[model samples]
Target: MDNKIVVITGGSSGIGRALCNCFIDAGYKVAIASRSVEILEKVKSDLRSEGHEILTVKTDVRVDNDCKNLVDKVIEKYGKIDVFINNAGITWYESNEDGINIKKHKEIMDTNHFGTVQCTKYALPHLLKSKGSLVGVCSIAGEVGLPNRSAYSASKFAMNGFLNSLRVQYLNKGLQVLITYVGYTSTNIRKIVKDDSKSSHFPPGYGDAVKEKGMMTPAEAATHIFNGVKKRKRSVRSSAVGQLTVWLNKLFPRLNDKLAAKYYS
Candidate 1:
């Protein structure tokens, strides 16, 4: 195909799904991957557009084999990948004192941090060959640790560090690795969070707080991400709140900590 191609992991819903639709609307060949074949098919059906290619892959980013398969399948369909998005991630609430679910924390890391690592590792060769743009769907939690998102924060921090190094490593090779410090957006992630034990990592009833508040829509976040990738930006703060977190943590570390404690504690 003469047109460019984009591949998005975790593309069944939320920001990933929004990116798939956005790229489809922009006339790019889009490949959407997730572990759920049913949801993936639903997304493909909903987002299908004329004269644009949309392929779905059942991929579990936590497994290296699954990640490799996703990359290989995409390469098989599209000769080259023009843009690769490592958007597969999972998160649950955790705290040192009360909601400390150690196992759940590890699970979060497996999916959020290592999942991105696995996908990126497999996709790197193809990305290098195409000199494509690569984006990590990180969170504001990556910049500063929130009270109840220790694991999630750690994963995103890892993501930023990893991609930052990758960006420099590939800069001379004409490849782009960008990070998006996304703030809470209206998505089903909160609703779908795992509770591995009776004393769940999640608070009893705090699931949709991000959505209930006037959070940014996934579409808006995806638009910001797409634009950043286009401009070859090193990072894009998906929300002013996320930007505030980064700046405040930088300039007024103590005050930022106090505020976070007050809000989340």
Candidate 2:
């Protein structure tokens, strides 16, 4: 994978960060894109100090022009984009009870679904040139409508449909579109979850470490993603829960809904 150019959004932390590390260790040129310049710079500095050359581009995937710029900048440096990972997404643990937060839902949808579409659209031409891979870091929430995650689920479901359609459209053309269904993992995402009023706050009963319990580590999930990329899997589940959720959603849709409510309601 030496010289392989991999671009990851939301690469400052969590699964994206792990993916960055994996690609760096594999001797691939990496570009981490995100809106947070401070965090992105910190991650880049930390990695570079360890002798891994990386590029941290300040990008907001939600912006159409920014998406185009992301592709343009990568191509400027690498001449081609070997892999583009659509990992930049946001969601809040608000109300799946009283109602959905319109403000929060729009934000989630903009960043997760439409954002992925825009980036993929901008990168498709380059990907076609390289016959490379397009990865969508969707969540199990997108696969099955779990309680407390309506917006997250909607965005992910939209992403699945969009990318799946593209996968079929480009199949004979040698492009690989991979979507990952991820279960809960230890990440800073929870720290940024918003309340019903749209203010970011930790949810009730939430603990820093407990939010990570019984969940796959981001590094572990990143390994699965990397392997899925290497194997050219069309779709991958990062955890057993994600796999089982798919099965249950198919065979027992009502049961899945009820069980999800029982656990998360």
Candidate 3:
């Protein structure tokens, strides 16, 4: 994979950042996209000091032109794309008691679902040409809805469906689509919700609950995702818990529903 090119969005932090390091260690050329120019520069500088080179692009995935420019820039630098990871996403914590916030839901959907779609649209041709992998960093919430995560769940479900459809459509076309169902991971994603007002409504102890010791680290999650992409897997569960939740939901729908409610509560 030394000469192969990999593109990752949301690449300045968390699992995305870990993935950049993982791929670099494996000798693949990496290009990262993020909305924050400062964060991108910082990551680039840190990696450069460690003797790894990377291309950084300022991109807001929610914008179509930005997504297009991201792919264009990567192709300009690397000539071809071997893997494109749709990892840019956001979430909110809100309960039914907090009242439905359509605006918040739309905001999440725009980033999580539509952002993935836009990036895929521009990157598809390149991926197809190289028989490359297209990956979605989805969540367990996509497999089974969780309480207080209506917006996040809906967006992920949409993403899952979209990626699944692409996998089928391109099955014989030599394009690989991989969806990773990630469970709770030690990432600051939860803390970066754009809506402070709604995030403040998170139930007491919710943060502690999510930060339990068993949660996977971003590096661990990145390893799972990297392996899946390397093997051209159709799907991967990032944790034992995530795998169990998906299977239980499939075999015991109602029971899983009740368990999900209790767990999130």
Candidate 4:
């Protein structure tokens, strides 16, 4: 995969940033897109010290035009795209006093679901040409809905559905589609956990315990992601605990929910 042109969204922080470094270490020409161009530039400069070819593009994945421009600019600079990683995402712990609200639902869905679709629309042609891979950084939440994450769960569920259908759609075209159900990996995402009380429907210390248990570091998660892409695995689950969740959800969705409540509630 040396010199492969790889594009990753949400490349400014956490798993996205870790992926940027891992791909560069593997000798791939990497382009990272995110809203924080300042932080992105800092990361690029730091990596350049190690002699990696990295490009930064400011992008709001929620916008179709921005996604288009990201792809266009990458191809313009690198001439081809070998892989596209849809890693940009956002989450809110609570939405309303009742349960999940339409406002938060729209925001999360737009960023995590539609944002991925928009990027795929722009990158599909390039991927097809290169016979490349399309990887979506979904969550274990995609497989099993969690308390206080109705909207976030819905968005990941949508991503999983879309990618599953897309895999079948592009099979004959030789496009490899990977949908990953990653579990809790310590990243800045936890810092953004909404003050659920402000929204009035907090999940009663939902994040407190889970944050300590079964959480891997960003570098650890990125290593798993890199391996999945390199092996061209159909689906990647980060941890043993994560794989158990995926299987249990598949085997008994309702049962998994009851178990989540037992543990998190």
For each candidate, C-alpha RMSD in Å?
2.6, 2.4, 2.1, 2.8
Regions of candidate 4 where Cα sits further than 4 Å from its true position: 95-98, 195-213
- Model 4 RMSD, rounded to 1 decimal: 2.8
In terms of lDDT, which candidate is stronger, 3 or 4?
Answer: 3
In candidate 1, position 253 carries an lDDT of 97
Expressed as tens digits, the lDDT of each residue in 1-265 for candidate 4 is: 3389899999888899889889888888999999987898898888878777688999999999999999999999999999999999987776445575788799899999999999999999999999999999999888877777889889999998988899999889988898888777767675565433355333333354336445777788888888888998889998786687668878998888788766533
Q: What is the lDDT of candidate 1?
A: 0.82
Best by lDDT: 3
Q: So what's the TM-score on candidate 2?
A: 0.93
The parts of candidate 2 lying over 4 Å away from their true place are 96-98, 194-205, 209-211
Model 1 per-residue lDDT tens digits across residues 1-265: 4888898999888899889878877778889889889998777666554444488989888889998898889889887888999898887765455556678778888888898889889888888898888889998888888877777788888888988988887779988888999877878777676433332444333456353465788899999999998898888998887788789999999999997766544
Against the hidden true structure, what lDDT does model 2 obtain?
0.85
- Evaluated at residue 239, the lDDT of candidate 2 is 84
Give the per-residue Cα lDDT of candidate 3 at 189.
79
TM-score against native, each model:
0.91, 0.93, 0.95, 0.91
Clashing pairs in 2: none
User: How many clashing residue pairs appear in each of the predictions shown?
Assistant: 0, 0, 0, 0
Q: Looking at candidate 3, what is the lDDT of residue 246?
A: 83
